[model samples]
Target: MTQTGTASKTVFGVPVPVALFFIAMMLPTAVSVNLGGLRLSAYRVVLLVMILPMLLDLVSGRRGRAHVFDFLVLAHCGWALLALINWGGVAQGIESGGIYIVEFAGAYLLGRLYIRSYEDFAAMARAYVGLVLTTLVFTVPEALTAIHILHDGISGAVGGPMAPYIEPRMGIERTFGPFDHPILYGVFSASSFSLAYFVIAKRQLMNFSGMAKVVGVVLATFMSASGGPYLVLMMQGFVCAWQRVLGDVQGRWAALFSLFALAYIAIDLFSTKSPFHVFVNNFTFSRESAYNRILIFEFGSAEVARYPLFGIGLGDWVRPVWMSDSMDNFWLVTAVRYGLPALFLLLALLIGLVWTVGQRKNLPPEWRRARHAWAFTLFGITVAAATVHLWNALFVLFLFLIGAGAWLLDAKPDPKKGRMTQASFKLPFRPAARLF
Candidate 1:
């Protein structure tokens, strides 16, 4: 008898997963490993802990193919096999593959395990939003410092061999703002920022209050100087246009949302105080680096042409053919490293997800709206992935959760003696869902 509402069990009645999730979600402090003469980040080191639960399950009790988690596991296996085969060129094939697995895949799975119910989902949403906010909080100071350090507006940040591959063209600093990198931070901001828009837009549709936070975060993302985020976010607007084409939900707000998105883009394009300029200064100002991404993209296409079957390999990004001395633009990276197959898998997963979510005909109206935004947000994120890898962990994790969560709720609703059982999965922590 599965308990309804809150107070329901998570993962065989253990509360540790949620706690573990919090720790894992915290912005990691520096740490690394010492392999003889080599050292790796402590953050990377802890990533391994995330794999234990899944690994144990795989070994202890095998599950049938009907399981939702199975696909995620399959993707990782494919990634591993690709890594092994391509070896990313033994010359510089070295990357924190283990850490990449744990940190990137681990975080997503943690979200899934902990976000088992509706309240949990809300909590998860808040937690994810919180991270975005956290990044923004730190970014204010970081950007200020970065500005002073690099002296923004004076000239573009100087580009060196270690600078962004595309910086030579754009001249923008692409400042990190307390994140690992400015471009990475911007990508994170854009992904979460898009999610925030989803929330605010839904609120408008529902006549709910809380548009303030989304406004603030969107502003913060603009300051990150990462061109990819700007480009991806713009794509979200295009997606909303497509959604309107699908006729999922028709109303003034839908059109208004589209209009608002366009207005934002227009303003950014003309704004002279380019956030990109502040960060990259020089990288984006030049035509050479501006066009370099195309060259790199071509590089990937050539590699794919030579090896169209399987990719160079998944784990070997730093290898000569794929990611060697290049920046991450989602489509090219996937095509180069794993060949065409990996990129195809990505498209298939995204399309399949969009279809499943769009088919949720039984959820409560509010839940339906929430899921709609989820799908649209994903659409934007996928487009953004073409230019940024933030989708790798932070954004992609949420997408997987939505897909699995929707699948979990597809069964017929429980008809209580009273009102119809909530047509959604209630979280373990929501006040209404709470057991206490």
Candidate 2:
């Protein structure tokens, strides 16, 4: 799939950029390799590989264009740096805040530069389907035998501490499946399920392969056995129905706001607790964990009121030695860590990305497939992340989703000339004819 006389050459079958993107996205986080006496996770190494070409492109005066969302993401990082600076000294900001920016913001930049068109995006989708299928092979064995082959095997090689395995819950041993936690594993698969289905629905994937991908993602989700992922999958169904039955996009938003209002009113009338506390208490599988989360949210809310503008820098805001490890909700973590301004910037990034993709009506039919795929992917992940702490690989993956949506939103289609416009590009492989 080479563009003649261009740098987009194929490597081992896939285009070079697409291959690097695929490796960076799909390489198992449970694995790592050492280079020059330094140990690094597989994803870090793959990201370095992806970044190398981008750096070369910059040197060659072929640096990719930036979008508005890039600045919004940067603002989120800038706020995070300020928070870290307030919490600790410059060293902490440089180490933690800088790394956060590189992991989250860098992922979006890499995605925007590499995945410039729908064809590149589809190649990534195909690679994602492959990842789902491959993960299933390990998960199925782990589900039945209670053996984490990938985790156990890679632990020795990585020479770093791995997340400890927990006992089975609700008669299911939550499968790690190459992710740090079962919840993340589930959210990752469930997100792929929605994204793959969106692509399939748009006829981007061959019938058989698309169906197989859907089946594979479903199996992986169930293997994760996390309530959060199940909720995310359910939300995808709700969103699909909301889009179909509930008028249009605006109508869906109205309905969502109405539901939130009703839930808030119900919480006020029925209990002496906040809606978030009431909602998570019933939604979570582990009552103990859920209670702690409620306490965290309660304590974090107080911290927000006290430091509404700038926020009380990190340290142990949540009391009790047991629960002080973290605040589970991604939104809460951002608010408590970086203050309300940072949280607002993050919200703007997510909402703006989704709105730009979902509201676009001028995209080509093929490009439209990617638009919907990314919209639902972000929506599902947003819902999932609300209840979970997104760190490491998952946070990077989320930023990649935002970057993809931003790229698609800025793209323009040239249906008349059949040329690559700022919005659309010609496919390297004929999607209609390809089976895999």
Candidate 3:
């Protein structure tokens, strides 16, 4: 349903639905219940609770025109389930596959339905900034003390530890916050970098509060001490700088793409290792970690080649005895677990959304800025996911962000003038008191 007035329902300056999603994500995984054989965590429970309303909105056309990415998401879920059923029996397959459907499709539909306007998106960005600030209170201390306060407290209240202790790196502990892993925590924090700077800053890049938001995000990211999150921060920072400096230049993005292509070709032609191998080696934290990822890619791709259709499912993959069973790469893991089609559909949804949203014309300056922010955020995530595996909250949040951008596609221009509309980018809440 459309908002009644100029503003939407909000709590503490954040949209109600957006705040709910953030709260669900921040909840400790320990706060969960087992249903039959399935374990449903806090975020999963939230998704389950919202599924009916989301479906009804979709059926009634209240969410507006559906995009190809929506269908791709559904197809990805459907094919994944079919493949799982083919590998395992129907009962086992449904049991395993249903979890993914709830996590991916459910979170995605929430974003697609509730966040249907500029006000909602801006509120989401503001809520994200607030989340980064709040989490920093836990992440900084956790990084120094090697004790995750929020996670430990929740686990203690629930009678057990939720996550295993990760050893310190570079004479300091890697911060886990309330997430499953330090990298996930870092990636989640890093996702807001572009949003905070581009969307929150609006027309001025050096706005004081906007810079504070950026610093908060950077601090939270550094607490993770993981290469994946560091890469995201660096990439997003570079893109932001590029836009600020050369935004008026024609074909700037095309030039950047061409330069990357040239570099990839040069590395492939001259280097002994493949471009992908070199990329993995250079972007990792330690020599051992780099070598391990290289071996994983080498072996994981082989497994995908062996089982190109339905994948091996729960069966053990053929890897060296010394190699770890964990697959660090999310894209490779998807291909290895559910076949190439699953990966293809996911890639299509991601690439198609970014491309289509960027290509939209006649958007106001505010909408255009938000589009760029969302695009670069996804761009960094796409590269980072190739390096680290994402699961649970991180995965659901990724899908939700994608769905939240669907409103850009259906945005209408000034029909009478047939040109860009000039709309003031003002939030409904008091800027000075609420934003900072």
Winner by TM-score: 3
Candidate 3's clash total is 0
Q: Write the per-residue lDDT of candidate 1 for residues 153-174, one digit (tens) a residue.
A: 2113222112232231133334
Which candidate, 2 or 3, has the higher lDDT? 3
Per-residue lDDT of model 3, residues 1-436, tens digit only: 3332223466754556667778978877777899898888888888888787776666665555454567788899998998889888899899988888888889888778766667667878888878887998988888888878877877779875666878788778898888878998999999999898888877474698887888899999989999999988888888888888899998999988899999999999999999998998899988899888888888999999999988877667899998879899999989998899999999998888777667766677887888888888888888898899888889999999898887776645444422222233222222121111
- On residues 277-352, what C-alpha lDDT tens digit does candidate 2 reach at each position? 7778776888887887778777778888777665666666846775666777888788887899999988887886
In terms of lDDT, the poorest run of 10 residues in model 1 is 427-436
Which candidate, 1 or 3, would have the higher TM-score against the true structure?
Answer: 3
Candidate with better TM-score, 2 vs 3: 3
Q: Give the TM-score of candidate 3.
A: 0.91
Cα error, candidate 1, residue 250 (Å): 8.1
Candidate 3 ranges beyond 4 A from true positions:
1-9, 13-15, 203-205, 413-436
How much is the lDDT of residue 288 in candidate 2? 85
Q: Where does candidate 2 stray beyond 4 Å?
A: 4-18, 21-40, 46-64, 160-163, 201-209, 244-273, 309-314, 415-420, 423-436
Question: What's the TM-score of each model vs. the native?
Answer: 0.65, 0.83, 0.91
What CA root-mean-square deviation does each model show from the true structure? 10.0, 6.6, 6.8
